[model samples]
Structure formats: C-alpha cells, structure tokens
Target: MPSIKAALSKPFAKLIAKRIKKWASQPLETQEKVFQNLIKKARKTAFGRDHNFDSIRTYDDFRKNVPIRDYEALRPYVDRVVNGEEDVLWTGKPIYFAKTSGTTSGAKYIPITKESMPTHVNAARNAILMYIYETGNIKFVDGKMIFLQGSPILEEKNGIKLGRLSGIVAHYVPKYLQKNRMPSLETNCIEDWETKVSAIVEETIKEDMTVISGIPSWVQMYFEKLIDKSGKKVGEIFKNFNLFIFGGVNYEPYRAKFENLIGRKVDSIELYPASEGFFAFQDKQDEKGMLLQLNSGIFYEFIEAEHFFEENPERITINDVKVGVNYVMIISTTAGLWAYNIGDTVEFTSLRPYRVIVSGRIKHFISAFGEHVIGKEVEQALREAIANTDITVNEFTVAPQINPSEGLPYHEWFIEFDIEPKDESKLIQKLEASLQKQNSYYFDLIEGKVLKPLVVTKIKKDGFQTYMKSIGKLGGQNKIPRLSNDRKIADTLYKLELTK
Candidate 1:
C-alpha cells in the first residue's frame, strides 16, 4: 500500500508547483501593493497605533515615519512582551520567544506570535516544495526526513516559552511527517549536542533516510558518527538519501569533504533562516543564488553596507537594489519587528527573480587597521586558494590580532583541516594573496607597513567542535562566526588549547 504521506505530498507538491510559478512571475508593483495591504491590517494593532502606522499611506510615508531599529533598540519592547505584557509589540503575548546567541551585543529573544508562526512554518515547507517542483524530485516524502535539530523541550520564562528556532519549527512539523522523522523525540531533548548526536546515530543507523537537514558542520559530525557506527560510507548506508538541506554557514569549504564521505555528489538546497525570520532559499537548481521571498509577510529594506556606519545613512527598498552591492538587511514583520536591523549583509546575484547571496554579518569583520575585511572576502579567498589544491578545510575563523608589543597588527586565521595539503606553506601564501586581491585596503595596509602578513594557525582536531560544546552552542541553527573585529572568540579558542 502507498503511504498516506506520499499520497498527500503529491497534491501539496502540485499546489506549491503552481504557486511558485505565479510567485516568480509576480510583478514588483503587485508585491509592493500586497505589502501595503499588510501594513494597513497591522495598523489596527497596539504597536501600529503607537508607531502612527495609520498615518502611513505609502512606502515613503512608512519609511519617513519609522526609524530603523537594531535588536537592541527593540529589546525594550521585547522585554515587556516577555514579562507578561500583552498588546505591546504584537496583538497579544508571543506564543514563543526564539532564543539566539549574541552577535556582540548579547543574546536575543525574538517574538514568534500566532500570525508569524505560519511564516516560519510555510517558508521552510515552501523552500523544499519549490525545490521538489523545480527539480521534479519528490522521493523524500515516501521515506524519511532526518532534520538534525535542537531540543524540542522548551523552557518557560514568565509564562512565555523560550527555545531555539529549529526546536520551535519542529513543534509545527506536519502531522504527515511525524511518522517519517527520526532520532526519536527522546534523543532530541538531550541538551548536550555530542550526546544527542551519539544517541541519534545509535537510533537511526538502521533506518532508511531520504533527506537530511541542518548546519553543514553538525550534519558533517553526524555523518562521521554514522560512518563510525556502520563502518560504511554514507552512500552505502543510506542509498536512498538524495536531498541535503543546509543553512547558517558557507557550504563551499565543506562541499569537497561531503562528496568524499558520500562517494558522490548529491542535490542540495541552501536557506537563509535567522532568529528574525526565514529570508530566502535556493529555489532553482541551476540558479546562482536563492530567490528572495517578496510576498512573505515581512516588509524588507536595505542600507548600503559601506554606508551603514555613517550618520543619516540612506535606506533603499527592495525595488531599488542593484546587483553586486552589499546591503545590510532591515525588516518589519507580522511578529512586531518594525524596521528592525537583523545584522546580516547580502549581495544580490540576480534581479529578475530577485535572488540573493548572503555575504556576511554586519559585525563579522576585521578592520583593526582600517582594511575592512568582511566574511565574503574571507570565504572567496579560501575558495580560490583551495580551488586547485587537495586541501579540505573542515572549519575556520578569522580575527584581528593587535598587540603593540608584538610590533604590527595583522589578521589571524584559525583553520581545522579534514585533508591536509601536501604543501602547507604554498596554501598559506595562496590564501594571503587571494585575500589581498579581494580587499585592496588590506593590501594597501600591508604595503604601508601598518599591518603584518596574514598569519595562519592550524586548529587542533575537533577543536571547534569542543569549543561549541563548551559554550552550549553546538547544534542546529548555531554556527561559529567566520570573522570577528576583536579577539574575544579567538582568545577563548586559544584558551581551549587548540592552537597549532
């Protein structure tokens, strides 16, 4: 007998197929009009009344009236909502608060109300659905989807629930998928990531999994465990696995390692989901970037990342964005975030269907000597350096090393290698050269003797994994920042005795 899940997926997939086509062909004007309609509806809420949302008629009016806010600026309102305050930020108290690790400021508690839950749930569903429709691959529904997720057991904070975003998303997983999901709820609630992964490996080693999703690092950990437990390659153990879904970090550095483990290349999807909202996802297999979600309830705005630090910086809307320019993202959503800066930076790869490639975070950069090196530049540098080499860098992080006693300041790279290169010196030289080519300012600083040559530090085996475990940020939706303007994280890693 055919599975009910499989049968139900056929019609749901067909519906998503049609909707994605219509959504892709949707005009910018139509999307803007729909956004305005949403704003009109929100204006009746308490938050709207306080912000004079009723007085807004046009996008221009909305922008002029609402000052762009960072997570810190919105923290006051969020605190109220957490402390049993209703109709403050949203219509009522949030159903849950999506807890996230701090960028630099501190940890955040983002509200997820009844209205906004669907945006999280449907956006994720639609990402896979769109991929299924575009690629004509629906074999996943027939088998199982093993989402490497956080603990579903939520903690209560003054009558309000608090948990990781991935955990909260699991709560809303479709009933049809409940039977096909893995690791068991018992294993998922294990707070320690390593223990949880071990339990998951033990439980799912014999299951026929068709799809898997999580941050590439954690998934890679799981893959290693599976190989250890089964004494077989991933492809051999799970022959039916076809789709790999991932987000929260750059997938380039890990791609080669993944292929080596599986013994073949598999279709994969990339997503841009944050504590703030699910932003975009890779829709078409052939496309260079993920398509932006225009009709999602979130209203989007952008500020040129270069000008973001300037006083009275100009804010640009979705219709005005140009390709290749890095922009800091701001959003106002149904969850009561009004013109909130989410701290991410992205560059549009295509404008026709509005596709974007996440560049880096607003705070994730090294500019100690005014060189302004961002995560995009670092990843590009690594990609170019490893392009022709036999190197497989497992994970890496960059931070500024400034010490007047040490003479000159320079950027330091801490890398964990899965497959070491035959020529380590050659690889380092290539990495430095590529970085200089990517950031002219960094090159200029080197020429002026204001900074030393880039330093490469080989991290201990499983160094990053151990560090993440120590900090309790070890699983889904949590990723180590690739770059930092300061040495806090680097010093901490060094303290863990990881330096080579």
Candidate 2:
C-alpha cells in the first residue's frame, strides 16, 4: 500500500514542480496573455452552449454583458454543480469543495474543479517560493512545513464523504512536494474543534518544524500552549524556524506581541486567499502586504469604496488602479463565477498592478458612539501609540458600548499583553490621544460628548484563545473578529467581562 501511494504521489509531484517553474519563468506580458486566454475560456464555460461565442469578441463585451455576482447569487449554481450537474460548469469531475466561513452569513462551499486545482496549487507554491527568493534565505536543512488550516474531510452524509478546501489542497499538495510537506489533516479532522486544537498543540511539540503557517490569532494561541507545556518561551521553540507565513486577516494590531513571542524578528509573509479563489500573496518578505496575482486564472475588478453599489459603479482595470485608494475587490474566476464580489477592501501601495495591501473588510467598521473608524485608521493610531510607549499587544478586539447613564458610546479595548508598560495609565492615554489626533472624526465625536472616552481593558494572557474556543472557532483558518461590526458580538463581550 505504501509503495503504491509513493508511486502515484511522485509523478504528481513532478508535474506540479514543472508547472511552478514554468509560471515563475514566464514574462509579465506572456502571463497577461495567458490570463486573457483563460478568461475567454471561462466566459464560454460560464455562459454555456446557449450563448454565442461569435458575439463576444472584445473584453468590453464580456464585462458589460456578464452581471456582477455575490456568493448568495452563486449558491444555486454551486448547489447544482454539487448535485452531479457536472456538465454545467465543470468540464471534468470536481474533486472537492473548499468550505469557507462567511463574514456575516454562515458557511460557504466553493467548488474546486480539476482544471481550477492547478491555479490554487501554483499560486500557493509561488507564494512560498517568492518569499524565499526575495528574502534570500532558501538554504535550510530539510524540515517540516506546518500549515494550520481547516479540516478537508467533511462529515459523511448518506455514506458519502464531502471534502472542503483543505481536502482539495491536501489532494494536490503531494503533487507539489512529495516528501517534505506535512498537512495538519490528522489534527484538523477531529470532530471537536477544541480537541483538534489540543491535538495540534501536542503534535507541534513533537515535530522539528522549519516553517509555521496560519492565521496570527490561532498561531498565538498555539504558541501559548507551547509556553505552558514546555516551560520554554516562544523564542526557544521557534528559534530555528526559517519563516513564518500568516494570513486570512490583518496582523498589524498583534505584530509587536507576535514578534516578541518568537524571541527574534523572523521573516513573515501574508496571503490573501478566499474560498472563491486564491487571490493574492506577499511576493517579498520585507513588503507590507501581499501582491495580487493579476495574471492568474482570475479576472479582477475594483469597486470604488465610496460608491460600491451606485448604478454604473466606477470600475478600474489592473492598469488603472492607484496607490492609497480604497476599493472593494470583485473577481471572475474559473469556478464559473462572474464579476463576483468577495467582500474584501484593498488599497494599492504601488502603481504596479501586482503590489497591493488589504485595508480591511468591506463592512467591518467601528462606529461606537458615532465615531466611524476604519481598519487602516485604527492600525495607524495603534502603531503610533505603541511606538510612543514600550508596550506590545498579542491579540486585540475593540467594542463600542453605549453608556446608558451618559447616553453615549465609549470604546473598550480588549488587548492580550506580552509586555506591560511601567506606566499603564500613560500608555492608555497616549493610545487615546493618538486616536483623537489621527482620526479627527472620532476626536470630534468624543469631544462633542457624542461618545465616551476610550477605556483600555487588559485581558488574561490567553483570553482571546479561550473566547475563540468557547465559540467553537479556534484553529488555523479561523480568526477573531477585530472590530465588532455587529451588536451581538458586543453583547457576547459584555457577558465575558472580567472587569467592571
């Protein structure tokens, strides 16, 4: 059985290697041309045999005719595909569906066609290779690469096993790295989320790891467990790790504590992957955020953040995007999605089409006490305040609560600390002052008595993890909600209050 598995895995791995090399060596122009061709193919497949190909020759024709779509709009089609409607969207069998947690809704299942699998595999491989190339730290002993991700295997219904995104990746990973990579399948597959976390912690201690990849919040939780079990600091356990790649959400608020936990500054990479598509990844280790893979098998569109749903919304092509302008990302992918809005907001850092930064989620804004605050503004204020004072944060969440007696809302900051400042009050004051200065709107709201003053609530070192576990959402792909966009989240926080 082992020999048969090896025989099948080796050839698949070789094919993946060839594809990665080819993609890396291709010129920018060639990549764009390939993307254009793929787009043409996808249009034909998406519209089906009912549409006339001769009528759609120009890019404008495709863009103008195909309506903009969202996950809710695509659910019916996805359901059809899953129910053995193979001839509709997929040319061949779909090996798995990548399940993703919805921001406001519930779980979403995205189909992974055999044809689309290579796009996911290549994007992921190139993301890692890009980091190594840019950092010039490719030389290291053969060690394990740990990916903290969701379980691929879904519960069996009617004796048929369903597979999620993790499963699809698992199926293809052996094709890319036959021997060196280790999937967190065994740990993630456990039925209970908490049990899975415990198992992962136990297994991580036994491995000689070199690369650790996951969402920042969950990774911090795992590190905390290591600290408790080994009686060694985070730096000691990860001292030999060559790289740490993280993504799924912004890590700015937790950056200082994360770096401190690892003992030394290590190379960090961020990725922008979604259930709909593997959208972008950090091309260089030193860069701030990931660059969009413009030439991949995905068509891109940007909706102006200020006027997202206005009739005839202003759309920018890859060549037209500018630096520092917030836009909601929309994508057309090989998975038969057309003009799909993935609900992510991004800003370009450079004029080059590929370089960009994830600013925040489209609807995730803090408006406690009428002070509208976006992710970038909050991150900037936090960074400035931390620079002023020598305090570090590992995990954090900000909630706006209405003071009933005062008839105003105040900002309550829940932060997990690594290093406590000598003057805690001073640190809190600086953070508040910075917010008032940097975010004038918030400042006016507070000063006008529209909102209450900022209050810092220091949490137990592992408070966020405990909260995540309590909600059955503590793992690699799961993330803590930073700015509670909903009132229910605030209610939950109110219930967990350890401070008066």
Candidate 3:
C-alpha cells in the first residue's frame, strides 16, 4: 500500500513521463528552443556583449563568435562574480556557487542561476518519478530514503551562498519528501565522513529504509557499517529496500560488491549530473545509457575526442551526432557557461532520442606510451575479467608504470578486492586480452613487445580509503579517477601500502 503522498505523486509521475517522452522524441526542436532562450537571457550581460551574443542568430554564428573554454580560461569572468559584481557572466548574480576541488586553481566555483537551479531539483525528482511510471513500484516512496552526501551547511559570500553541489541540493529536497528523507540535519552536518556514515547507519538501521542513493563506493562503506552494527546483510536489515540511485562515477565496477553486501538484487537507476546542470538520467530501466535532457535549459555541443586538442575542431549539435563515437561534450547553459568544455567524454548509444554513456574524461587518460587507454576501456576489461569469477572488487585504479624497477614497463593496476580470485595469472591474461581488443594502439604496443604484460598490484583492505584520508579527500563526492597519465596518485598508493 502506498501513502497518500505516494498515491498522489504516482499519477503526476506518469503525466510528466509522457511530457518527457514528447520532448525527448523531438531532440532537435527541443534543443533549438533552449538555445534561443539562453541567447535572449545573456544578450545584455557583460560576457554576452564581449562575445557578441547579440548578433548570434544560429548555432553557426554562435560557435564562431564564442570560443570553447575550460574553467581556467573562463576564470577571469568568474572572478568578477565572486567579487560581488553583477551581469558579468549572465544576467544578474548567480543564486549560488557549486564549489568543487580543482587540481591547479584550487577550489572552483561554478555558478547556479535562478533559472538553472530548479532544473537540478526537477531532473533528480523526475528520474525517480520516471522510474515509478515505468516499474509501477511506489512502495519505496512510502518509506525512508537516504542520500549520502556532503554536509548541507553553506557559507555566505557577497550575499550569495557557496557549497558542495550535493550539499546545495540537500536544501531543495521537496517538502512532501522531507519526512521520508533520513540522516537528521544534525547528522548531515557532521564534517567527518566516517562519523557521518556511522550516524546515518544508527539513524537508518531501525527505520523502514526503502531507497538508498549516493556514489556506490561510499554507499558500499555505509552498507558495510550497517551490516556490522545490525549483524545481518542489508537485505535482511531493511526488508523493503528496493531502489538504488547513483551518479558521479560508473556503477558497473561496484555492482558485484554491492550485490554481495545486499545479499539480493535490487533495481537501480543511473544519473548523469554535474554542478553545471543536471544533464541526463535513466528514464527506462532497460536502456544502456541515460536519456539526454534536451529541453532542460541547456544547449549541447560535441567535438570528436580525438580532435579535441586541435585548434578549431568541429563542434556540432545533437542533430549531427552519430552513434558509438567518442566525443567531448560541451555546453552553453542557462547558468551562463558559454561554449564551456565540461571535461567529460561521452559516446552515443542511441541516435533517435539521443542517449549517451560517459566514455571517459578529456584529460584523464593513459597515453604515456602512445596507447591512449580510456576509462571505459579499462573498466570494461576489469569487468570482463571478473565475470563468473569469485572476485568481487571493492575499488581499483589504473596507471602506467613508465619506468619500472624490473623489465619493460607496463600498465599497473591497483585493485582492492573484497573477494580475491583463486587464479590470479589467468585473471591478468583475461584483463590484458580484453584491453588489447578494445584499443588497437595498446594492442600494437603489446604485440610489438614495446611493453610487458600488465601488472596487478593488490591494495590492502581500505587502502583507497586511507589514501583519500591522507590527502584530506576522504569521502563525500570525492572519487579517485580511474586512470591517470602520471604517478601522482600511483606513488602515493605505493607509500600507503608500504606503511600498511
């Protein structure tokens, strides 16, 4: 039986699902409309005048007049907004800044406008509603749902608020769902992730928990804590737990470990969200990728990932994109990001309604030896190698061992296993074979004897957690990149393992 709120929300979910299908079916028209509105909004602003947004009549003119820029390139305009200036990037000041850690620039402040803020909340809400419309399971709505995220506490700067995107979103959980949300405000405010997860487990262990949402790695930590305190698997502790919603990182790598912890299968929905905007989410349970949010106050652009580093690479809209090609995603959003490169690479899975799967990051790849192995390829290799085996991997990362102490250098895999496999040598063969299949460059390098067979370095239990803690990025939206071009993290992991 559903609660009164759940009963009412069910029909409304169906209605919105219909509306979503209507727009998703007309990707080009929906995006054109969003593009027009963004240009109209930015025409009077400082960035608009400088970029000549006034004379931009079509995507061609807009692309020519505005150059694609990363966060560092656009920081001059953002510094103005941070210093209490108005109409610098977009119309008026941003309502809030989504703060995230940056490697070179320190903390990055991404603006969230009055127009763009609601889309974040609505997209997250509609993701669940679309799930209900498709599956007809609103029973989860009648029970508690917990979102493991950063502290909701925010800081005021120049009459505007700034905080982690997840924490900023915590303030916008709809009123009707407030009673059903877990981890008391006091509990959420705890700064330390270990303490926060402990408090969350204490609060939710006895409750009728039906839904759990967060990064899978952190959620795994929380689930282990619950099992430790309750003396039962998560499925046994919370009989009604039915849905898992996750984003920020690929969930495939953690799926097997989660199934072991839960002791049963549960439905899952994947989402593609960022501080810039809620870009996409899983609208159909059976789909391979998320439905691109065409009408959500964002205009999308793409450039072939291989050509992205070249000056003036072709930038095309959704109408021109094809399936299965890796492309770097760019956006001109209502939040006033103009031709902004969000640093993510995506591959299209469907062209009719424009569905995409995140392939990798533009900068995060291993090309040290001319074998540009991507995040997707490495993850797929690991996933394939672990299939049907007793291995359940907790976490893993890849880096090129450029200069090894031994023979020829090769790719080094740092894997933390929840259930170690019996045959380790066979596992490496499977992994290397899979990678060679997906990447021709890597294959040539391996076949040519330019590199040795990949090495698998076993990371001690909680080694990743310890590494993250040593660097002050323990949890809460922080994730280790799947691969890197350098040993910044690889060397650190080796040191952590030595101390352990």
Candidate 4:
C-alpha cells in the first residue's frame, strides 16, 4: 500500500482542494443559485428526451409531483442495470456494483457507475480535510490511515460477480502509492467478507496507524481484538492517531467510551453515505454536524418532520429549511433516483446552504405504545446521564417490549461495557431518571403509569459480537441494530437471548 502522503497527493486530492476552495469562497446566495442551476441541468439531462424531466420543474412541482421512492421502488431499475442495461442511471460506463446489506429487506446490489465514483472519493476526501481543518493538524505524512470497510474483492453468486464499494475503491487505487499503505489491496481484497475483516484485524495491529475510519461499531470491535492480540490497551495503540472518522450510524452512544479508550479527545468526522450516493459530509473540522453537498451531482428536498406523512406532504427546498427543525430528506441523485427517501431524517444546525445534522433514520424509532423515542433523544439522555456517572458504555441497543403483567410496553436497554460501573443500581437509576427528564413521551409513559421504569440488561463483553455471529453476520459492514423500531428486531434479539 502507498504512504498516506502519496494517497493524499493524488490528482483527485488536487481536484477536491479546488472544489473546496471554490465552495468556501462562494456567497450563500451564489451557492444556492449554483445548486439550482446544476439541478436544472441534471434534470434536463436525465429526462429531456422523454419530457418526464419537466415533471419536476418547479420547487412545488418537484415536491408535490414526485412521489417518494425507497429502495424497493428503485429495485427494478437497479436489477435492470445490473443485467446489462447500457443506458442506466449515469451517462458514463458502470465500473462495478456496490454490494450492500439490506437488513430491513434482503441483499441489495447497487450499481456504482464511473461517474459516481468521483462523488464518493471526493466526499470522503473532503470529510477528512474538514477534520484536519478543524483539529489544526494537516500533515499526516508519517501516520497510517486504517479504513474499516468491507473486503474490496468481488464475490460470485449465481453467475453474477458483485464487488462492494470498498473493493471498487481498492481496485482503482493509484498503482504507485499502493506499496506503503498499511492495508494493501492484497489485505483488503479477500473474497470472503468474514475472512477479510479478520485479516484486517490481524494487519491493523502491526501498522503504525494514525487515522482510523470506519463504522463506529466495527472500529470498536477491532479495538477489542487489538487489545486481545497485543495485550495492550486501546490508548497504547491509538495514542499516535490524530483523528477518527466515523459514519453509517450515530456515534453518540460510543463517544464517551471511544474517547476514553483513545486516552484523549480524538477529532471525529461524520458522513452520510448511501449505496445510491454520498449525500453529505462534515465540512468544518470542529463541527459535529454534517454539511449537505448541495451542488453535487444531486438535487435536494426536505419535508417538515411534523408533516412528513400528511395526506399531501409539503416538501421544502434548501432555502426554506430552518435551523433545529427535523425534516425528512429527499434527493434526486446521479443514479437516476428521483425524490428518493433514503430512510434518514436530518436537522439543520446552521441556516446556511450546507450545514445540517443527521437526526436519525426515519424507521429507527420506537413508538409501539405512543411513546415515540427517537435515537437522538436516547443519545442525548445517555450522554447527559453518563456525564454524571463513572460507567463507560462501548455499545448499546434499545428495544421496546410488552410488559406481560400490565399488557403494555416498556423499553429494555442492552448495553456492552468496557468497565463495570462502581454502583450499578445507582447508574441504572440515574439513566432512567435522565431518560424520563429528557424525553417527554418516555416520561409520560413512566409517570402516567402506562409502563414500568426502564430496565437495563448488562451483557457480557462480546454480547453484540456474539449476536452478530449467531446471525451469520460478523465483522465489516455488519452492525447490531441500534434502535429496534420493529417487532422483528425484538424477536431476533429474544431468539438469541441477548435481551431479558
């Protein structure tokens, strides 16, 4: 693998720098104008021949006329493209397919065209650059960068070979820089996903890694393995690392423990990456929230969270979004996805065109008993409660189950610990009090006597890991469901005896 410096010095980095500079200098109004113009052009190019493109001409038209399309809606198109449909979503040739795990449904094979590859690479590069800009350290020439991603090699099934996003990027790594990089293509290019992640764990300990990037859960698991292999603590191995970039899920639950493990406050960058496209990234280095890429090869739309499911859902444009209000995000991407509801909700941290925070997934909530407990609320309560406690939680999952005695519902928290609490009973009480105080609905559920006090289930060190393994899903790209909004998750957890 190539050295970190060489990888960052590629032509792509130069291109990204230019784009960043250009974006940074533009006025908000100018940026909006540019975004609108790009949207117009993309619409024209995408649908000009059939006149179907004109259907989304106006902001209202785009919102009202275009119905929300989910993964299922686009499944036919994705399947057709994979089956050798030449004129697919993008105008350029499709290099390969990005295999993704669809937990709610089944496995999904997404097409990653040549034109869209630059979007992912650029978004990722900008995310890192933003982190450096925030943390005030740029020259990582000597530090190693570890990416906890899927294996870069393709797996064949039923005569079709599928390469994941990680593999695709690995295949296209510039030849000259591949030698010094710690996780070389040979290490990342394993055909079996499990074997690849295991290899990654084995190789990660031998390198002088300075920047770690991956899903928060997998990185944590890797750290556990490192601790086992080296007989050293997380701080020892990660002390040299300057930053941690995590995405794909909320990192709030793991933040305290992660920082504790690293022994210092490591800079973090979050990204909103999807199989269809890279939607947004953390632009400013110190910013906790992500900035939506407004002028990329995509058009954006938002529906007020309160009215997202009204009979006539009113969609708002970028100019209409207000800071601190949650909205259901929609986008028309280069992948030919129109008004696609990517199952995520976001809130603007700043009124400017680019800044926003990923609130949570639309479906990743518990409202079984009219107590709507969202991920953000849970994260907030946990952070507040932990701030006052000596306990450290590495990972956690929350599910709502029926209370047989009352025939109502109650929430059960499954937490994985790095260190046992000094006073377990007090910790649980404090957590419950914090949750009740922070979330009004949860509070009502408890105070109104509809549900009993929240129960905490402390699991073994590798409880989540064991659960993942039980389901034939362990390591890279596989994560324990953070919020079990549906009955299936609760059922699955019950079957595995991971929950009480």
| Per-model TM-score versus the true fold | 0.95, 0.84, 0.99, 0.87
The residue pairs that clash in candidate 4, if any, are 1-178, 1-179, 1-180, 1-181, 2-177, 2-178, 2-181, 134-285, 152-167
- Listing every candidate in turn, what is its Cα RMSD in Å to the true structure after a full C-alpha superposition? 1.9, 4.9, 1.0, 3.8
How do the residues 1-500 of candidate 4 rate in per-residue lDDT, one tens digit apiece?
Answer: 64556455555455665677576456354445644554455454423233344555555655544577777876766676667655545454356667877865587777665556788877876776555445446545356677777676676643445766765665554444355355766877665545665677788776767778788887876776677777877668756777788887788778877877666787677888877788788777656577777556666778886677678787767767788887888877655666778778888887643677777777777777777677777777677767856668877778877755555567877777777677767767777888787678878888888887777777666777777777777766666666776656556656777643
Task: List pairs with backbone clashes in candidate 3.
Answer: none
Q: Give the winner by TM-score.
A: 3
Q: Point out the higher-scoring one by TM-score: 1 or 3.
A: 3
Candidate 4 Cα deviation (angstroms), residue 96: 3.0
Note the Cα lDDT for every prediction shown: 0.85, 0.67, 0.92, 0.69
Question: lDDT, candidate 1, residue 458?
Answer: 87
The per-residue C-alpha lDDT of model 1 at residue 408 equals: 87
Off by over 4 Å in 4: 1-18, 21-51, 54-56, 88-93, 134-136, 155-161, 174-177, 191-198, 406-408
| Model 2 alpha-carbon drift over 4 Å, by segment | 1-39, 43-54, 89-93, 103-105, 154-162, 175-178, 183-185, 309-311, 367-372, 420-425, 433-440, 447-449, 498-500
Candidate of highest lDDT: 3
Which model, 1 or 2, shows the larger lDDT? 1
- The C-alpha stretches of model 1 lying farther than 4 A from their native spots are 1-11, 103-106, 404-407
In the range 1-500, model 1's lDDT, one tens digit per residue, is 55776656667877986876676677476568656865776776766787788888888888778889987887888878878888887677888999987665577899988887887888889888877677766777788779998889899998989898989988998887799888788988888888889998888888888898999999999999999888899988989998999988889888988988887889999998877778888988988888887767778889999899998899888789999999999898878888999889999998888899999998888888888889999998899888976788889999988983677888889999888878878887888899888889999998899988888888988999888878877776778899999898799888989877
Tell how far residue 472 is off in model 4, in angstroms: 2.7
